[model samples]
Target chain A: MADFSTDAARALAGPVWLSDRRAYAAAEFASMPPPDATDEEWRYSAIQEFDLSEFALLSDVRGAEATPSGMGDNVLGDAGAVIRTANGRISSIEVDDELAAAGVYVGPLAASGQGSAQLGAVSADATDYFTVLNDAFAVEPLLIHVPAGVVLRKPIVVTHHLSGNRGAAFPRLVVHVGADAQAEVLDYHTSAQGSLLACPVTELDVASAGRLSYLNVQQLGTETWQFSSHLARAERDASLTASTAAFGGGYARTRSDVRLVGRGANCDLLALYFGDGNQGLDFRTYQDHVAPDTTSNLLYKGVVSDAARSIYTGLIRVRPEARGTNAFQTNRNLKLGDKAWVESVPNLEIENNDVRCSHASAVGPVDTEQQFYLESRGVRSSEAERLIVAGFLEEVLESLPVAAVRETLRHQIDAKLSQHVEHVEHVELDELVENTELGGG
Target chain B: MSTLVIEGLRARVGGQDILKGVDLSMASGEVHAVMGPNGSGKSTLAYVLAGHPNFEVLGGSVRLDDLELLDLPAWERAQAGLFLAMQYPTEVPGVALRDLLRVSVSTSNDASEIEAAMRQEAKRIGFGEKFLERSLNVDLSGGEMKRNETLQLGVLRPRFAIIDEIDSGLDFDALRMVSARVEAATKEHNMGALVITHYSRVFEQLKPDTVHVFYGGRIQQTGGADLAQELEDTGYRRWSNENG
Candidate 1:
């Protein structure tokens, strides 16, 4: 597909170490077969219809042009740094003087020289086919490193703007929070106009007693296909919160894996996704507890209207040595149109009897009781459904670790509902009423 | 004064007739108490008037003065000045009471004014602003839910209110407070109210202008406020045989 040759990977202008690694990954990726729906990992995915030959790699060089106006403007008032990329090229990078003086580095991983060594440290063990592809052709990986005991009071914002016609971009980000440090990072993925492919990989490494908050917001064009990988590891007494908000993409899939490597580590994983039109959003998550007294909680909520569909499969695993581990997983979905559908599956596997684990999932249409409650209060039926769906997703949106993005995300959700509410009114109420009888209150 | 007239109101739910040719009329600033035993269609009447989707109206005419309320949807009926305080308020998670009240009182476009008005009502009802900011009816005690309903009634100030079994779960003090709020709303807004209940204790504070005995889906007796105490004293045994 599109000649992903090792020679081509070796031709890019980069450090010798990076070029050699890309060449090796390209060779490995070539030998691997493309994933399909038959594989359990790709179950319910649209991988079979994905055509890699439709796109060609654009470049390996980072851009230095001004970010297009309104492309990725700061929603948060103050930021420690702002990095902007266009079509896999770095448009600009701005770091606060104080942050830089505190030994915090935000720039190209390759420019960091020795710091580039930590690029794949956290995600190496969780590599899949797409991740391997990302390694082979990723134009330039961004790195944000906070040294020991340096707490960046403001968040670091990274915006990736994709404007390609039948082209592909591989964006990678690596974040390292040193021991006893604290950091918050926000990544925005957006596109202008083009049928494109994006394979992104993010790695988060939090050291002992460190705290990190990370959020990824994807608002790509509807003609794009996105396969993203999120890998995170927490050490002793560390805390990590990772959240994702997916609103646009023809077929978008996110695979998240979180590992508690040391005792007393804690993590919170949250996601909010809304699919309208013909969109398909799929999610797969794994929470692995390898040490004692570790805790992980996951909550994912989604809404699908028109002919859109969604699938969520999550698992909580407690290893034999992980005693006194507390794990909880929940996935809830709402289908506003009769043609819309959802599939939610949650599982738990605990090897230690001392562990506490629970899993819950629900998939159904909007609650008629809730609709009636709002209607009885003088809200029109269409407006009632809109409010209910918005309120349903508000739980996860409000809980986003980044307080600044919460209101913007909520307004985006309302905008989506306002456009689709009229279509929802055309949905057969009788069908929804029947679904109401089958659904839980 | 405005009048609400209901004539030959017939309705059924799930293939069972719950309202059978009932007739009644009331005016603004007047309060009527509908008392009966359980399963006597007291709640069915309230729901039918509110145009709940579950009920099928076989034949009826409900008019608020000259407006035909039976022809409109529930929300339009509400916009036309009708309010029903449901017995079991549905819990809508993530929707705050203040936001809901802001939407219900559609006349005011200024959100801060509505918020201030709601805050005043919340204070009068002994509810804090934080409580108003919480999800509507979620995790609320029975007394709190009833109080929340009273607060909405106060803010909405509808012309007519059909309160269904508001005293079921309230303690003595809560019942007294809720009834006093309803009385104040009636005096302030010239609101007409039809209070439905199985017990007579609520009337001790509400002081209804008239009382009607509901049985077999129709009103069997009409009298002054003493009618509630008579039924509470003797029970609804006499009206039980009317279905035959």
Candidate 2:
């Protein structure tokens, strides 16, 4: 309806050399209609309110060279490589010589032409409006490939920064860990304060006996709207631990689909989201177990305060052929304000009787027992509540692979807590104090 | 003289009176044991003193060294040198024991001295480094939880302490170990204590200066340490039947 045709896709692709891929994806996007609230996948989302015609797909920015403010430093400390993109265009790429000598490729996806295979591999199975749109217009895609048996000691950090207003950006990243390889990758998304749209897609392919640790930190501007999709596939004996920290964005939604396709493959999915001040944070996850003895554990925790809202719906599906699969899904939400709302739905679809699957969900305020416990230890009521909330989120934060990034996320959570405490009423000391003249003298 | 004074304290849970007109007083460096049968308001007294919201104080006056504790919040009372070793210490997930101890001690002591004292006290309580790093009271044994509470007492060194049922659910050796630590803390800080228990065994290890028999939410009788042995031999049936 918004006229995202082949010619427009070419224009949005800018000077990128992936014309054929862009054209093919553009034709696909043109044939498919935009998702509405009626679609099962788009339920409980503000998809009906989304107007693709409101924002322009700008291929260039004026201040693309300037480093955006609030971009975290040393996010991937001691990284083997760093690739940065601004306004959907590659700004810089650097790789360690030792890693490069071991056949590790870290550079632009379009330049190497290695991303097309994995790029559409995931979205092809279950296409979404945003994924098709991203495939059609993603100008500069980043790639990180760790070759067979190459165990890189350091991670590969990728930063995507948006700088202009009233524009839409499509950022893509493809990660491939070869057989017996191990690696970690971190992606940071930040932008200047303005109304913008960001649709980012990340695809991870873990080969047999490979291990990958991936982290996505979304710190977009307060006025920005982000819709991100992440897909990961783990092969035989492969393990994938994918985590996300969503702190910023006016209306942010992330859908992650992880598939364990081979025997004994394992995946652990962890996510933390905090929304404040009329914001909305939504997440939909699918853990598809297709092979025997495969396991997936998912834990997602979030806090909503002010007039903010959050929704989490996750499903763990065990196929009929997948016996002896052990899968667990947990989603916990803390509503700090009376007006704040959260909806958590954890579902299990197990076709195999031999599989073990359990799902748990909770949405409520902080535990009063935890609050009183802290208050009894000389912590003030406000500080006590803060400590409880922090402690509630600490498990996921500490599980982060990078200490520096974890520290940064902790600081962000603290800042949000401080701001939230100002607008809410905590347990009062005067109220708890006993009256002196109630009983007879 | 520094003292903890509770005069005509009355409290109720959900409109049912639990601590009815309770009176107690103890000076610094004094150890007083309160033995009572189940449902006699022993734990309620400790919780009301700690400002637990579940217990509504109908009327009371609690003071520690001229500071009116009844008018203060739990944290303020704690800041004014009052401590409570709960009968059931809450299980706070993701909060390490070391972190809780550091914060609790820093409220009344120097920040720089917390880590060293924390490590020392943790080791003194037979807690390994891993135990100190584990979540507070999570997956801890009954004895370990009691020891952790005693460790907090050592860290805070309050002017007064209320330990409720610290000896319950502990084996003989664990009971001895925990009682020894509680005794050491009270003596080292020169603090007054109100030890609430159902058994006289803990009093034997603590060697309390006084023992009080509690029934019907009030102290029915008060006597020297021998009272503990008398109650142990006779049981609480005598006082409970008289009060009922």
Q: Write the per-residue lDDT of candidate 2 for residues A73-114, one digit (tens) a residue.
A: 766446788888889888888888999899999987765646
Candidate 1 residue-wise lDDT, A291-386, digit = tens: 999999999999998888899999899999999999999999999778887988898888999988999999988887788888887888877787
If scored against the real structure, what TM-score would every candidate get?
Answer: 0.94, 0.94
Candidate 2 global TM-score: 0.94
> Ten residues in a row with the worst lDDT in model 2 chain A?
A427-436
Number of the predicted model whose lDDT against the real structure is largest:
1
Among the candidates, what TM-score does chain A have in each? 0.94, 0.93
What's the lDDT for all of these models? 0.87, 0.85
How far in Å is the alpha carbon of A195 misplaced in model 2? 0.5
Q: What CAPRI-style quality would you assign to candidate 1?
A: medium
Collision count for each candidate, in order: 2, 0
Candidate 1 scores a C-alpha RMSD against the true structure in Å of 4.4
**Alpha-carbon DockQ of candidate 2:** 0.70
